[model samples]
Target: MGAGMGMASDQQWLQLALTGLMVALLPLSYAWVKGRRDRYRQLVWLTLFLTFDLILFGGFTRLTDSGLGCPDWPGCYGTANPFLAHANIHAAEALMPSGPVTWAKAWIEMIHRYLAMMVGVLIIALMGLAWFKRRELRQSPWPATALFILVCVQGAFGAWTVTLKLQPVIVTLHLLLGLTLLGSLAWLAARSQPAASHDAAANRLSPWIALGIVLLAVQIALGGWVSTNYAVLACTDFPLCNGQLIPTMDFRHGFTLWRALGKTASGALLSHDALVAIHWTHRVFAVVVIAYLSWLGLRARRSLTLTRPALILLALIALQFASGLSNILLQWPLPIAVAHNGGAAALLVTLVFMLTRSGPDTNQKV
Candidate 1:
């Protein structure tokens, strides 16, 4: 709700970029020195790793109620970091001690931004390297190029996440885009390596994997919806919601995507039934996801190349179930909630990695 772009000075933006560049140098240096061949691929995988971290940290920022810690995009109180904006943060906190802005929360939010920018810089490097090495590189440069654009769009959504006052739709889309970027990077990383031996079974399972991805994407969206709306505790019990199999729910209001956070489109306060609807839908749909993905993982295990990732997928499914339960049973512990988010990303990465290798060798070329 703060005047996002109008509040931040140009100097703050420059400083933010500088900090990101500094953070990116660590991975750049590592890739440069550690890689003897296919450094591009090395950087891609590195970017993927950091991106996974960024997503988890983003979840942390949200879970801790730090989304509005700085209240404006790309800077804290028109400054690059929390230290420079301490007076403002302190004033806001002092005025409302339980409110969104606090020194610690500001740092958490700003640090999340800094990591995001670092990932952006690395992706820029990837786009540049891919284009520069297009002739000799094993994989196509276009996907890397597309990744750069995707990161920019993700950054936009990141800004909107704050500026739009953490609207559920915007936040959910932001989460989805982050996962999409992770999955794309996973595929690119897989392509940068030598093609594995073709598994007819894995190839045959491609359509099923595609179906699983659709279901997984839907489940993740539902999860994001629940998280953004803070509806996880709407159903504290495992098998029942509000001690009933079918609790009263306001599906119309709950599924209204464009409304403000905790409010309906008409600006009335969101109802308990709406929250229950959000949480319950996610809970019920999760069963379909678990069953389908479990079957997919088991089916994938029959493939020689996909067996390991398939096992990892099954493990992640179990982790999701456990962490998800912990969120409800433990009243949404920070570590468990964040791990639940990270587990989703890991599942997507593993699944996409499997999909990348599932194709025929002829189509495997970058």
Candidate 2:
């Protein structure tokens, strides 16, 4: 809306349409593979799997500081593919050499966009097929239609995440929206699959299990804040923060919800104390998430149907704990850090799977 940002470029519009057609072929191929018996269900499961992979790759893009590799939203340098934008990308890299706009980073950024578009195309096909087979499948296509709409919203935030120059709040919201979409697809897949038999005891604890999910979601938001602000190394130690149990923290500015990328609301540079506050809050919340989710796991494990997801929850929390500790002790190795992001996503989907199976809507065989 600003004078500088202006309207979309002519090249950008044409390139985006070409990119859409390219990614559309992916779903067409996918449907052909699962042409027999409840193929829509197979499509749902496959899309959910790809979405999880996209989230992890998105983490790779962020952690490598390649968010602005192309310096544009959907396309790289006004072109859909890096190969076509080679001249523009090389010029930018030559100007900044070791900066954000490099050839490798451009490839990374463009590939991420391509995968996102592929996921969107698959979701659209899901809506189409679900409606076409509604008579035989005896299921409404509304859920797939809803997913297609959600992917559009997610794509908008993805554009903002780049165009806004990775503003901390905007970037964090973009990551959250991706995870939410992943969970929605997982729930959709679970709905299509036949429900496993659930015993009486597991049915009784659905409310408490739901409560645990909410708590985990809050912890994830705190983790996102710590990440988007680049405050992970504020403490440089696990159990203790900066050699004190409760270091001096600037909660006032640290938790100011609406601020720019690396500055406070008043445009002052973010302070070390504020960074400590954000990091410490995430650290403290992790303990609570681990304990409460484990307890929920124990209760749900008494029933055969809920046992596997509960066990998965326990494993993911353990992985999260180890990876978080490694980030501090090892000075944030890329592999461990990316794994930590995947751990959170796995935990979220596992919970969604459990909830779908336990609810009354999933009690009957497909």
Per-candidate clashes, comma-separated: 0, 0
Which one wins on TM-score?
1
Instruction: Please tell me which predicted candidate would have the highest lDDT against the true structure.
Output: 1
Stretches of model 1 off by over 4 angstroms after superposition: 1-8
Estimate the overall C-alpha local distance difference test score of candidate 2.
Answer: 0.85
Model 1: which residue pairs collide? none
What TM-score does structure 2 among the candidates reach?
0.94
Worst 10 residues of 2 by lDDT: 1-10
Q: How big is the positional error of residue 334 in model 2, measured in Å on the Cα after superposition?
A: 0.8
Each model's lDDT comes to 0.91, 0.85
Model 2: colliding residue pairs? none
User: Candidate 2, residue 57: CA error in Å?
Assistant: 0.7
Give per-residue lDDT, candidate 1, residue 208.
Answer: 86
lDDT of 2 by residue, 154-233 (tens): 99999988888888888888888899889899888887776667566677767777788798889888988998999999
